[model samples]
Structure formats: C-alpha cells, structure tokens
Target: MKLNYSVYLVTDREMAGECNLADIVVAAVSGGVSCVQIREKNLPTRQFVEEARGLVEHLRPLGIPLIVNDRVDVALACDADGVHLGQNDMHIKDARSLLGGQKIIGISAESLADARRAELEGADYIGISPVFATATKTDIAKPLGLGGVRIIRDNVQLPLVGIGGISAANAADVIQHGADGVAVVSAIIAAESPEASARELLQQVTSAKRIV
Candidate 1:
C-alpha cells in the first residue's frame, strides 16, 4: 500500500465534545489528515459497523482511507480500506486469509519483539504505541520514548506510525526519530478546531520528513 502516513488521525468520539465524528473527520481531512482510523472500543458490533460505513462514505470522496481499528469483521462489513490490529488481536496470517491481500493490515507494537513478529507475519505497517504516556487509553504499556522508535525503525522496513501522547508540538520530533507519521487521538479530536490542528500536525510531519 503506497500510503502517505503523515498526519494520521485515530478517532475518539468521547473526546470530540459536541462535534460529530464525521463532521470532525471532514474538517480534519480538509485541513491535511492523510488517514483516518475509526476506533470504537465500547460501541456494539452493529453500531461499529454502521459508524465505519458512514466514515468510509465521507473519506472515499476525499481519497482518504478509513481504517477500522481491531475489527476485521467490521472492516469487511463496511468495505473499509483496512484494519489496525493490537499485538494481542487476531493473528496476521488469519486476518490476511480473510481480508485477502488488497486490504491494509497494521499491527500495534509495544515492544521490539512485537514489531519484528508483525513484519515477519506480513503486516503492512507498524503502529508504535505509547511513544509517550497517554491518558487516552488506560491499558497501554510504558512509553517507548523517541529512542524506542529509532530502535524499531532500525529493525523494520515497514512504515512506522507513532501513537499516544503525540501533538503538533512533538510531532516533528517523532518523525525525526524515524516514524513515517504520527497517529494522533485527542490532539486533533479534542481541539477547538480539528482542521487547524490537523493542518499544524501535517505541517510538522512534512517539515520533519524533508529534513530526514
């Protein structure tokens, strides 16, 4: 998948305040978000499928991909572009058999071992989680820090996306440390202006990539 991972947005409806999820996504994509992942942890299966289907309609027109988080079934139901899997989620081999080779499959790696295994298992990309401590997800591992990103980059050839506690302020640093992009949650979703926030984040990642 020749994806431009810069300025990745992971959704959190709870943090969106009064903004509608699709509305926030439209505004963010208009600003510069390259990718959007629908991550509904508590929503029922039917609602999750409905939400993914809705976002796919919004994103497809803009040429942006909508990734369904940790739910291959939901992705299949919605005809989403891809699915993001946690380290403990379904085996990549099994996921591939079901989704086929056309769909993108991203694996979250909390450790070097996890990253290596994902690559060996044929994951399309690697999501480096908790690059810094984050309140967004209560059950994440310890922060990997910038050094951890460099370590994973050194070992893996796939694209790297740094998630957890990422914002415009540190997005450039994350890219400099070797991430192809930053997967942000509250930084964009909770902002007063999701468009402006996404614009700033894309700018940061773009500039850093130029330097790297």
Candidate 2:
C-alpha cells in the first residue's frame, strides 16, 4: 500500500471527551486524515481487540489504514493494517517475525540513534516523538524540537512523522523540518470540530510539503 503519512491521527480516548472514537476518526478521515493509529495503553486486551475491529469496519471501506499501538497480538486479532511500537515495546525484528513482512511496522524515535536503529531494523516509518512537550503522553522522552527532526532527517531515509504537540499552528514547521507527516493526539481528538481541525492540519502539511 502507498502510505500517505501527511495527516496521521493517533487516537486518545480521554482527549476525545464526549465524542466517540469512531465518530472522531470518521470525521477526521473525511477531512483528509491519511492514516489512523488506535492507541490504548490501559484497556483490557479483549476490549482493545474489539475496539480495533470496530474501527476496521469503519476504515476498511474508506481505504484508511488502521494501526494498532504497542500490541502485535491486538493487531493480529483484528487483522489491522499494521502496528506502531515504542522503544520499550516489542523489538522490531520480533514483531516483523510474528506479523510477517507484509504488515506495516512503525517505530517511535526520540533521537538520531533511535531513528538510525529503526531504519536498520526494518521499520516502515519513524514517528519522531515529542517534537514539542505534550501533555497527552507524559512518559515520553524529551521533546525533539525541530532541530532534532532535521538532524534525524539527515541521517535516515525512512518516512518521518512528527508527534507531540503538533497542531495547525506549527504543523507546517514540522513538515518543513523534513517530516513526511505529523502524528497528532489532542490536536484533533479534543477539538470542538474534529473535521475542521483535521482539515486545517492537512492543509498545513500539504502546503508545507509543496515547499519542501
């Protein structure tokens, strides 16, 4: 599949407030979100699997790829498009061995070395975590400002997706710094109008890519 990381949505149930995850995701996709990652850190395994399956029903026909966060089992259970892993999660090689080479595997990188390692280990893409400090995920490593992004971009050829504190106001800068896309949490999840927020962010990313 040709992945368009342009506007990536990382789901956060708490940040979503009263809105259902399916509704937010459906709305966001309609507004131009190119990818979706379902991240459930505390939910039970069964529930996570069910949630992912539910999303698959919504996204499959739309041609959107649904990635399960941190759980190869859940992805397998739901037959998701792929899985995104953090450094502490399962190793990429093991994940690839289990998920097989056909599924997409994304890794989170907090430094240049991490990005390099991910590339060597066969990650399909690299998510540059905490491009700016973010409240959505407190345990993440130090923010990798735009400078970190540029340095990593210089070292790796894999697709880069900037995460943490990304919003319309700075989405352009993230792309200009060399990210192939931006992965966002509350920026779209917590918005009053997810469609509008997604539209605005996608516009910023698309415009910046043209310049890059």
Candidate 3:
C-alpha cells in the first residue's frame, strides 16, 4: 500500500473532548487527513481490538489506512493496515516477524541514531517526535526543534512525520525543515471543528511542500 503520511491523525479519547472518536476521524479524513492511528493507551486489549475493528470498517471504504499504535495483537485482530511502534513498545524485528512484509510498520525516533536504526530495522516510516515540547504526551523526549528535524532528515531515507505540539501555524515549518508530513493529536481532535482544522493543516503542509 502506498502511504500518504501527510496530515496523520493520532487519536486521543480524552483529548478528543466531547466529540466521538469515529466522528472525529471521519471529519478529519473528509478534510484530507491521509492516515489515522488509534492510540488509546488506557483501554483493555479486547476493547482496543473492538475499537480498531470499528475504525477499520469505517476507514477501509474511504481508502484511508488505519494504524493501531503499540499493539501488534490489536492490529492482527482487526487486520489493520499497520502497527506503529514506540521505542519501548516492541522490537522492530519481532513486529515484522508477526505482521510480515505486507503490513505498514512505523517506529518513533527521537534522535538521528534512532532514525537510522529504525530504517535499518525495516520501518516503513519514522515518526520523529517532540518537534516541540508538548503537553499531550508526558513521556516524550526533549523538543527536537527544526534543526533536529534537519539532522534526522539528512541521516534517514524513510518518510518522516513530525509529531508533538505540531499545529497549523508551525506545521509548514516542520515540513520545511524536512518532515514529509505532520502527525497531530490535539490540534485536530481538540478543535471545535475537526474537519476545518484538518483542512487547514493539509493546506499548510501542501503549500510548504510546493515552496520546498
């Protein structure tokens, strides 16, 4: 599957506020989110699987890929398009052994070394995190800034998605620095109108790419 990492949406049930997750996803996708990741860390395995399955049912028809974050079992159970792995979540080799070559596998990388290692380990893409310090995730590494993005971009060959505190205002700068895309959580999910937020973000990314 050819992935368009532009405007990647990582779901946060709590951060989603009053809007339902499915509704938020649909709105975001409608507004041009290229990828969707289910990242509920507190849910039970069975519940998570069910949620993934439900999302798959909705997203599959739209031709958008659904990635289950940090749960190989959930991905397998739902036959999701992929599984995104955090540095501590699962070994890339182990994940590949289970998912095989067809499934998309994304790894989070906070440093140039981690980015290079992820590419060597066969990750389909590397999610470069904490581009700016973010309140969304507590375990994030120190902010990488645009210079860090440039360093990682120079070192890695895979597609780069900048995460952490990325918003419409700063998204273009992230892409300008070398990210192929931007992975967002609260920027879209927490907005009063998720669709409008996503559309604005997509515009920013595409516009930046043109300039680059």
lDDT of prediction 2: 0.95
Q: Give the Cα RMSD of candidate 2.
A: 0.7
> On residues 1-212, what C-alpha lDDT tens digit does candidate 2 reach at each position?
66899999999998887779999999999999999999998999999999999999999999999999999999999999999999999999999999998899999999999999999999999999889999888888999999999999999999999999899999999999999999998888999999999999999999999999
TM-scores for all candidates: the values are: 0.98, 0.98, 0.99
lDDT of 1: 0.94
lDDT (tens digit, per residue) of candidate 1 on 1-212: 56789989999989987779999999999889999999999999999999999999988888899999999999999999999999778999999999999999999999999999999999999999889989999999999999999999999999999999999999999999999999999999999999999999999999999999
Query: What lDDT does the true structure give each of the candidates?
Result: 0.94, 0.95, 0.95
Ranking by lDDT: 3, 2, 1
Stronger candidate by lDDT (1 vs 3): 3
lDDT of 2 at 57: 94
Error of 2 at 180 (Å): 0.3
Candidate closest to the true structure, highest lDDT: 3
Model 1: clashing residue pairs? none
* Model 1 regions lying over 4 Å from their true place: none
